[model samples]
Target: MRDAKTLFDRLGGKDSIEAVVTEFYHRMLADESVAHHFEDTDIAAQRAHQTQFLSAVAGGPVEYSGSDMETAHKGMGITDAEFDATADHLDAALREFDVPKKERTDVLAAVASYREDIVEADSTDN
Candidate 1:
C-alpha cells in the first residue's frame, strides 16, 4: 500500500496542500453557515493547522502534532448536516485545484477515514 507520504508527494506536497486548503477556507468563509462555525476561530491559525494536518496525512514532511480530532472539533456543536456541507466544500476546493479525479477520490477517502475522530454528538445536556 502507498504510504501517506508517497501519496502526498505524488500530489505535489506542501505547496499543493496549502493551495487546496486556502481555497477551501475561502469557500467556507463565504458560506454563511460555515462562516458561523469559524466566527470564534483565528482563521489564520486554523488554516495553518489544516495545512499541517493535511500535509502529514498526505505523507508530506510535516508531523501534525496538533490536538486530537475530536478535541479540535469539540464544543463546536457541529451537526451531521454541517459536516456534510464541509466535506462538500472540501470536494469543491479539490476540484477547483484541478486535482485528477482519482487523486481526489484518494484524498477524500483519506479524509473520510478520519470522520469518526472529528465528529461527536452535541455535548449540551438539553
Candidate 2:
C-alpha cells in the first residue's frame, strides 16, 4: 500500500518551508517595489509567522497563530502592483528551490486566495 503524502510533505516539510520563507523574504527585501513595506517590520518574527502560515497552507501539522490576513495588513495601503511584486518574489523563491511547476502553482493559488484581504486600493492625495 502506498502512503498518501500531503502537499507539505511533497514540498519537503518544515525545514524546506523555512528555507523557502527565508529566501522569499530575502527576495522581497531586495525588491525596490515592496521593500519599503517591510522597512519597520521585525523580519525574524515575520519569517516565523510566515513559516507557520505557509506550513498550514500546505497541509502541514503546524497551525498559524498569526493575525488574520485583513487585520495583519490593515492600513498598509498595499496596491495591486505591490501585491504582484510580492507574489513574484514568492514565485522566484519557490523556483530557486526547484519546486515543481504543479506544486508552485498550488502554492501560489493557495496564497492568492487571500489577495482580497492583503491588498488594499491605492490611495490618492487628490
Candidate 3:
C-alpha cells in the first residue's frame, strides 16, 4: 500500500521551505512596487515568521506563531497590485527551486485565499 505524502513532505520539508522563504524575501526586496513595505522591517525575523507560516500552510509539523493575517497587515494600505507582486515573487522563488507546477499551483492557491485579509480595498474602487 502506498502512503500519501503531505505537501510539506513533497515540498522537501523545513529546510526547503526555509530556503524558499529566503529566496522569496530576496525577490520581494528587489521588487520596487512592494519593497517599501519592508524598508523598516527586520528581514531575518520576517523570514523566520514567514518560514513558519509557509510550513503550516504546507502541512508541516510546525505551527505558525505569527499574528493573524488581517491583524498583521491592517492599516498597511496593501493594494491589490502590491499583493500580486508579493505572490509573483513567491511563485518565482518556488520555481527557482524547481518545484513542480502542481505543487507551485497548490502553494499559490493556499496563499491566495488570504488575499482578502491582506489586501485593503482601494477607496477608488467604489
Candidate 4:
C-alpha cells in the first residue's frame, strides 16, 4: 500500500497555494462579518502569514511563522457565527480556484478544528 499524498501536494503546491491564499483573503476582506477583524491589519503581511500558515497546515515544507491561534486571536471576541462566515468565504475562494471537493473538505476541516482556539465570545461583557 502507498501513503496518501499530502494536502499540500494535492493542492498544486506552492504557487497554487499562494493563489488560493490571495483569493481567500480577498474574499475574506469582502465579507462584512469578518472584514472588521482585518480592518487595521496589513493585507500584505496577513497574506504572507496566512500563506505560510496554510502551507504548514497543508503539510508543505514551510513552517508557520505566526503566533499561536489562541494568542493571535485573544480578546478579539470572535463568535461561532463569525467563524462560520469566515469559513464560507474560504470555501468560496477554494471553489473559485477550482479545488476538488475532497481536498477542500480536508482544508476546511483542518481550519475548523481551530474553532475553539479562534472563537472567543464575550458573554460577560454584554
Candidate 5:
C-alpha cells in the first residue's frame, strides 16, 4: 500500500507539471539525437498535449486527447538508442525541476514501460 499523495500532488500539481513539461521541451530541442523528431512539429501544441498527457497519467484531473503512442510515433523511424536518449532527457528535465528521486525514477520507469508501443522496427535491419 502506497502513501495517499498522488505523483501529481507530490509533483506540485498542474503548474509544476506545466513547468516541467516546458523544461522537457527545452532539453529535447537541444538534444541532437532527438531534435529532428520535432523539426516540423507544432511545438506549442505538442507541449500542451504532453502536459495534458503527463498530467492524466500522473493522476491529475486533465484528460489527454492526443493520438495513441503507436499511431503518433508511426513513420518516425525511432530507434531504441534514440528513444533511450530521449528518455535520458526526460530524466534530466525531471531532475532540473527538482522532482524527488523516487518519483523521477518511477516516472521514467513508467515512460519506459511504453517502449514497444513507441519504438518502430527498422526495415533496414532485415
Candidate 6:
C-alpha cells in the first residue's frame, strides 16, 4: 500500500495541500451556516492546526501531536448537516485544484475514515 506521504507527494505535497485548504476555508467561511461555527474562534489558528493535521495524516514530515479529534470537536455542536457541508466545501476545493478523481476519492475517504472520531451524535444508544 502506498503511504500517505507518497500519495501526498504525487498530489504536490504541502503547497498543494495549503492551496486546497485555503480554498476550502474560504468557501466554508462564505457559507452562513459554516461561518457560524467559526464566529468566536481564531480562524488563523484553526487553519494552522488543520494544515499540521493534514500533513501528519498524509504522512508528511510534520508531526501533529494535537488533541484527539473527538475531544477537539466534542462540544463544537457540529451537526451532521454541518459536517456534510464542510465536506462539500472540501470537495469543491479539490475540484478547483484539479485533483484527479481517483486521488480526490482517496483523500475524501481518508477524511471519512475520521468521521467516528470527529462526529458526536446526540444519542449513542441509537
Candidate lDDT (C-alpha), each: 0.82, 0.91, 0.92, 0.89, 0.86, 0.80
Q: Estimate, for each residue in 1-126, the C-alpha lDDT of model 1 and write its tens digit.
A: 754447687678888989999999999999986689888889989999999998888777799989978888887767666677788898899999888888788878888887777656543422
In model 3, what lDDT does residue 4 have? 86
The runs of at least 3 residues in candidate 2 whose Cα sits more than 4 Å from the true structure, single-residue gaps closed, are: 1-3, 123-126
Q: Candidate 2: lDDT of 105?
A: 92
Model 4 regions lying over 4 Å from their true place: 1-3, 122-126
Superposed Cα RMSD, model 3: 2.1
Show the lowest summed lDDT stretch of 10 residues, model 2.
Answer: 117-126
lDDT of 4: 0.89
Q: lDDT by residue for model 6 over 29-106, one digit each (tens)?
A: 999977987888888788888877776776677889889888888877666777778888988998998988987877
Query: Which of 1 and 5 is the better model by TM-score?
Result: 5
How many clashing pairs in candidate 5? 0
- Report the lDDT tens digits of candidate 2 across residue range 38-92: 9999999999999999999999999888889999999888888888888889999
TM-score of each: 0.87, 0.93, 0.94, 0.92, 0.91, 0.86
TM-score attained by model 3: 0.94
> Model 2 TM-score?
0.93
Model number with the top lDDT: 3
Spell out the clash pairs found in candidate 6.
Answer: none
Of candidates 6 and 2, the better by TM-score: 2
> What digit string (tens of lDDT, one per residue) describes model 4 on residues 93-116?
889999999999999999999999
- RMSD for all candidates, in order, please: 3.3, 1.9, 2.1, 2.2, 2.6, 3.5
Each candidate's clash count? 3, 0, 0, 0, 0, 0
